[model samples]
Target: MLKAPDHQVAGHQARDGSLGPLVDGSGHFYKPLQNLDRGSKELAFYTSFNSMNGIPPRIRRFFPSFHGSETFQASDGSGLLPHLVLEDLVFGRKNPSIMDVKIGSRTWYPGVSDDYIQKCFTKDMKTTSMSLGFRLSGLQVYGSEESGYWKPSKKAVQSFTVEDVRLALRKFVSSDVGWASDKDTLPDCSLATRIYGGPSGVLAQLIELKEWFEDQTIFHFNSCSVLVLYEKESALRGKTHGAAVKLVDFAHVLDGNGIIDHNFLGGLCSLIKFISGIVAEANKALHGLESSADGLELH
Candidate 1:
């Protein structure tokens, strides 16, 4: 029997000899009937991911494996509700750190009219911006005992700005010289390494993924969580070694024709430029550090 993870939003594991795979169906955001549409969309998205053969193995590894969805009648005789079944991320790990953070700003669009932009800065900024990209919302770190659940570390819940993301990209790129040596080498490395490759490589993969989504005409992901998993026993004491990133949440995903949204494409390009700029800046910082060391030796 699969124990439910503390961060689960939609469904829970079934009890012994349960009729179906899912039990205790809780609708999205604590609303049983209201969120059926979102639940359906999320289920469909995972279904597609599971069946699609075109997705690269490296990219596919980042996503949680999706099981089939189940329908359960409401206890009050309301109607049938859908529940998505997924693999528990922390099941059987030694020490696992799970961070659930949303990405993107729903209201922060590039090149939008000032009127629209002004509207975003209002009191409902978070509510309005929730659909932009994945944002950090909830976090959990599991311990080794029966009471495995624990509060998230500060670093797990820490929020990052666009600049911070760019810096992270820069750092990853600068550090992984071997991975960045050949463009083809990207797919050979882990998902995190490829997604966080040198600015150009990372941007290339983003474009590739976006174009693939466009071809599939899958509605773009808005406000998905960037899930990072790290193990304590890995290299660097789990600080920088063996970390993986996967994107989740498809409640706002839309269906579309085989056309890419210009605004979305532009936003991606802008991010690429930011990462590139930071890469240059990081290089400068390293050069300065080296020069300082040499000067110290001379003195």
Candidate 2:
């Protein structure tokens, strides 16, 4: 059976009269097709991306595996619609923490209408996107099944500062912390070493993606989001089954025409730098604890 995604942290959502993405019990995500131009363009990009042999195998894992398209009845009673079938990133997780980070200071593409550019520009300036090269669209952190998910209001997220962005990244990987009450204080960041510091962690994966973005000029991903996800349950158990980094939202993707994608690259690097700092701080904190423990033993 298909239903609305409970873990979706951002973007368009299903409402009274509108439809959003759907997930099946079989671990498949179904995204409703947009307008003719955008829907077809996105499908083409995925098809072409998967078919191309030159795309490095290591980088390909960063994208959700596409399973083509399927026609399904719309949730809003708008009849049938075509949906893109993809791997459900949070399908099997018991308690998943997901964050959607939209890369690039500019979201519009070349040859777009002036009005569209202006709209995007205004929003970018209003948020951290313009200055920091990226913005946290939205996120949900697992706070136990009884407590439910902890997410900030849309207005609060829009008003976030540079420090707020860094804190959000740290909070995303933290556990059992009061996100709202402890806004000014730092979380334990105990999961930092495991979730963002290790070989298969988010930091390493992002650096790998950055390396690919540095050279690839085949496509310019406009307004695309990098989803950082991990299951709190699995992470606490010291398992890596649910940790991943996946690129999503291809409606505005454009042909690169051999030019470098400086916008996306710059934003990705900014995110990486922030993560690297967090890992370093977490290591120092751990070292401090160890030293204190040794001092106590000597006494």
Candidate 3:
């Protein structure tokens, strides 16, 4: 099953599957203001959905060993705590290229993809955003960053490769399909037959999951406070694509009070506005804001 990592909230309360808050997400005061301490972690399931490879909850049953955790401390002694963490979760596991046995479309077999991203702590670093990710199914293909990240930088500790575990995970998750080596019979299923909802549905689920993805990595660190981010890939009719769902990150407060006012959507809109202004001022490309029917914040 997909086991979630342990975590600290707002750099204070600590939470795990067993230990939980006595109240809802919003409460108040050490008086049980009632919370899952700053240490409480988010669910890091490969696929939080009901299916994987024709099997129900494929991501969970397949990658059983996938694990991770986080801890936080207020570095400035400002009553807010910073967080620290370590984990081995799959982020970019698809290949940049693929060939489908079916048609003219290029396909990826959860293609070779795995790597680490780092965030550095600086005096001016006020925002800490994060997100879970949504990936295309039937064909696992991930693209690359065309350019470097804009501002500050944090060096990742090591390199990662998706091929290291993709085969194993596929074996583990796809019960009906079996492993590529098995050469098993074609099960009474179609790739779409395993579809819990539809392509759009699966895409939406992936989009939402990105939040916890960062919670285990990006959000887990020593800082002013905790900031959770999430970006969901959208359902497209053509080639595969990935979208950024996560946007705003809350600094330190030991209780996650900063984001009390903004939900994930609100935070994202704010971020889009900020980026739009910057690009406009710098005369940077607005990507496809003008031509595309989808209205981006840069308008």
Candidate 4:
């Protein structure tokens, strides 16, 4: 049996008075669901990723570790729902600033082939939005709420915008000399150096991850949420600190045969191109700042 913290409610209550998914005191995130097929797919994804020979360690570092699942019956004997448990990514972090942004879709463009675009739209409209630009759909800062359950923080939500993404992309593009110069390589780099902490190590890691995903060829991340986490104090101090980017929500993952899926590739390429543009714009702004700072020093 799952036990919630004494001070915190286990799951969210719906308008119908039924319980939703809950997190236990042990830091296990339980996602309650009625769809068994979706649950099974997610379980398989976690299982495959968690296996020793499955996903690469560098790429796997960004994923939340999955535990297992159990069927929980309502106390009132109303019905049962499968509770999928996984390690809480935001747990134990001090005032962790978290943003759950749906990836893809926002950066899409109309210039892409109609057939490809239509295929992507048919597959998933949300994922196709990445070609448009980054859009802030939901934001949450853990620990701000007194109840311990995840709640949206207004201040934190306002802090990040499509502009921030642009800036981060600039930092990534400017600092990623290797990937930027290599015309043979795809336009992809790490956001860690720009927004989070340290140098450009994570960019290389991200490239490796992208390559790994490309190599798979059989599966594609249909729709996923990019979870960005950072310490509030670190962000407020304007200092480099620990931060993480995790990909979650695999309900829309698609599988295919050996043939390459152009629609999938198109979506991925669009997202990469969008990030590159954002980063380029950000780099220009950073150069301006540096020039101003240099002028002040010269005086």
Over 4 Å off in model 4, which ranges?
Answer: 1-19, 52-54, 74-78, 106-130, 133-136, 141-206, 236-240, 259-299
Candidate 4 to truth, TM: 0.59
Put the candidates in TM-score order, highest first: 2, 4, 1, 3
Candidate 4 per-residue lDDT over residues 57-138, each given as its tens digit: 7677878888878777643246786767787676666656455545555222344468756775653443224433233435
Tell me how many clashing residue pairs each candidate has.
15, 0, 43, 19
lDDT of 1 at 261: 44
Candidates' lDDT values, in order?
0.45, 0.83, 0.23, 0.49
lDDT of 1 by residue, 1-299 (tens): 22323344222223343222322223222212225365676777888779987777756765777767655553334467655666555445445555554444552344446785677545125331233333344444333344444443344334444443433343333223333324333211222322333332344444454454445444566545555555533422424333455566665555554655443444444443453344344434545654433212211
TM-score of each: 0.51, 0.92, 0.24, 0.59
Alpha-carbon shift of residue 281 in model 4 (angstroms): 5.2
lDDT of 2 at 259: 85
Least accurate 10 contiguous residues by lDDT in model 2: 290-299
By summed lDDT, the worst window of 10 consecutive residues in model 3 runs over 99-108
List the lowest-lDDT window of 10 residues for candidate 4: 5-14
**Number of the candidate with higher lDDT, 2 or 4:** 2
Q: Which is better, 2 or 3, measured by TM-score?
A: 2
Task: Give the Å error, residue 242, model 4.
Answer: 3.0
Give me the candidate number with maximum TM-score. 2
lDDT by residue (tens digit), candidate 3, 81-107: 323222222234122212111110111
